[model samples]
Target: MESSSNSKAKPRSEVLKIMEGLAQELYAQIERGEEPVLEIPSRTLSNTVWDPKRRIVVLGPDKLKRRLLDMKESKRFMQTILMLKLIVSSIREGVYPTIRDLYYNGKHTITFRVPNVGAVRENTWDEQAESNAAIEDLEVGLNVLREEMGLSADVKGKVVGPIVVRSKGFEIDATRMGDTALGLPPNPDELDIVKIEASYVLVVEKDAIFQRLNREGYWNRENAILITARGMPDRATRKFVRRLNEDYKLPVYVLTDSDPYGYYIYSVYKSGSIKLSYESERLATPDAKFIGVTTSDIINYKISSDYVIAANERDIKRAEELVRYPWFQSEAWQKEINLFLKMKKKVEIEALSTHGLKFLHDYLLEKIHSGKWIE
Candidate 1:
């Protein structure tokens, strides 16, 4: 499907202008006999910092200088330039290409001979990782999201709620989708959120649970929007949740299993992940709450011991790492992680079914209404 003409025009012009500016800088440098360089913010773990005030991870003040004349940086510089050209060409041609499509489009072998050395062959990029890195570099360097450049990625989020959104000139009402849901687009920012009539947003970690709640009409009764990314969330899901909270002032409550992995999912939604800290400003929902299946619930809710799973070494290690995150330093989170470590036991949200299948609805209402969630 085509994007709405009005929405497409602005992003196309804006991104092209930014790309043009980068090209102009390089051309002027070459004309003056100076080596051209691109200074992009360093996207290293060491350069990712937690902002205490903003309550989110952000890229630190370190920059990498990619100089065309430097041997070590030349290939990466070339890759970035090639990606820029490909993206610019796509924008001009009005064709949206996925990252994988760009990777194959740009992949080719170059051969050249050196003194006393036979012909040497090198690939433009050995793998998708290399190509994706270049795309990310362009994102940081140009201060533009790949979505703005008409790039697409696999979208994995779906929602059912009292929300109405307009995408590509088509209006979608989540409440009217019946057993299905409104599939989130790759770029949620491009969606025109026309209306929201929900008291809160319920973000379920597992798609099955999301489906159960949707099918049971849990959202309709609670006046909530139900969303799920299936597992670890993608940028579109995170961004869409952030918009719901930031723009519409809806409280976001994440429901996950009572384990380290589940906690980490909530962390990614609320505080942003370490690797993609640069996107936190647009993606993280600082006010999102963790509402369920906490380690303590295992005992409080009288979940059957048979439903409990012993915390594996990996789970313990992940919980330890989470304790060190700045956002997880809250008193409630501290207590929860410490308890998980001490008990070395975990439980799933389905364990609540020990009471009844419909008990999940009661549990959700209890958490939100009683203010029994951790930040």
Candidate 2:
């Protein structure tokens, strides 16, 4: 099985050599008048296999080759070439550019030639999504992630807790670092842990929850580290959480709103997304438990119906799909999902505010203390 690659990346020289070699091979193929083809793993569920025990989604060996000569592959071929050149240039210059930076860097080159009109500039991706797809293609083609290719994205997560990190050669305690926990740098592949007095780590799905906990000094009282992805987690935040769990052997628990999207967020932390399944094992927090604000919580807490939202067709569809996932095939998870299906209602973490703002704070503490959580 293809396990995930950790953030403790190989030396830049070594990674650069691999990327350069790929570029050279493509160059040699063109020199010989042969159409260059890039073989990348297909990013589909049919091409992915899940390891339930490991809680990781790994890629299969089946590969899809993008050839330059095909009409369908023409745009992708151009995208591949542009991204590959950028990767090589970035590596040669020893600069790690984020996905956004690369999109802008190559935005000008997004031109197509017309038979009568020379080169016509076309507006291709209004955002970085296209650039990201090209990056992933390179990942599967080279059997290395974009990060391993020495590329990263702007950090989009935060942490607030009583843990000290020796990052970039400085000892900083996250707890005493004001309201916002030290924001992780864009490139956290080299973060070194110094000291952690926390008993466990709590990964909140939203920033509001993290801020509330910080305001109440929950971390101080519980002796736990608090982290939030602010929504769906980015690679850096996931890697950082995995590091804390693996390095410190601290129990990691996730808290998310009791909704399909929220559950998916928890799943992203527990098991990496299928889009980036190649790096699942390294980034996924397999041991992290879900200390949820489940549908059951509404009844358990005696929350009023006004606080609950009726599940729409879209919500039900998503929930149904989630239940069929291999990782979610558990007695506890099935029960929770069934409850949602039967009641046709979902609850957000904020619903706890209905009881009282402090109710959520106390509820989380109670669950953690009593060991009430689902896998």
Candidate 3:
């Protein structure tokens, strides 16, 4: 039960140096006829602490030992070593690979043979999910993101705005792209925001809403950048939104359904998710405002009750849990969560269709101008 103050994380170069140091230490141990022991942070949730001040989850220095002599531990040790070699070697060669690429490329080296019996065994990392989990474990141990290690996930999400980007030997003017919105690049590390001439940033929960806005030329009319993560925002989308706020100094507003899940989506952008909370400092946008389709909006807009969906058991449970979380305990947020629980109902942004196809568009402009948002 110790804090993360024991040690600080390092940059990518230092991470590579630490891996090399570990490898060298193991080599020295073998040369001295001793068993090599690898010490790494335990990725167990019990060992993870949510730091309220920093607003991110961090690992304690509760190191677990893996010795080369143990049979069960040896299999994991071998897998870790192989993966480490792949990562470090790839970085050295200036080649970045996705987790899936690394899995297929390194899966063959993971096969093992039984002593004396000669039975060939395989699957140290049986599937891509296993490899992905291992990568997360490595991140927790190293206290750095995989992207920093010259690795990236398949990109998700799309953006359209008066923003210009220069990266990977190409320049793009998003506003001049006409109707086609830009798909977020896989390697966002190279993307340099050349210019952002938007009044504010709008982050929507659903792609359908994003498309509706885009098709109606909402960004053109409002002079705002529009973005969507499809459903749950990925690291790339979150980071991009953060940049729109931090780099461009634009106010960011989230538009989501009047449901618990939508609330959680807003929370993810503002406070970061629990799983990837270690990188919250870079991912979370604490300044983002929640401009929502709230419970009162249904009544205020006079949407018929027929379009309203009953809140399922799971929705209520999630809202209850979120209301107790430290990050969602603010008076405004608490009231919203409480109202949803009290009403026991939910409504999507699509319900704005009751008035017209473009009602939601007008709603956004009105909300922004009137400063009707919850932080």
**Most accurate candidate by TM-score:** 1
Clashes of each: 0, 0, 0
Ranking the candidates on lDDT from highest down gives: 1, 2, 3
Name the 10 consecutive residues with the lowest summed lDDT in model 2.
1-10
- RMSD per candidate (Å) reads 3.3, 4.2, 5.4
What is the model-wide C-alpha lDDT for candidate 2? 0.81
- Estimate TM-scores for all models: 0.93, 0.84, 0.83
Lowest lDDT 10-residue stretch of candidate 3: 1-10
For model 3, state the Cα shift of residue 11 in Å: 11
Once fitted onto the true fold, the runs of candidate 1 whose alpha carbons sit more than 4 angstroms away are 1-10, 113-120
lDDT of 3 by residue, 1-375 (tens): 111211222445776887677678889999999998777777666767777676556665688877778987876777777778888888788788888888987787434577887757667677777677667666666556677676868666788988887766688888886777899865454476677788999998988888888888999988999998888888878877876676667899999999989988998888786666566767788888998887777777787889999999999999999898768877888888888889888998998888887688788987788898887
Scanning candidate 1 in windows of ten residues, the lowest lDDT window is: 1-10
Which candidate, 1 or 2, has the higher TM-score? 1
User: Of the candidates numbered 1 and 2, which has the greater lDDT value?
Assistant: 1
How much does candidate 2 score in TM-score?
Answer: 0.84
What lDDT score is found at residue 108 in candidate 2? 64
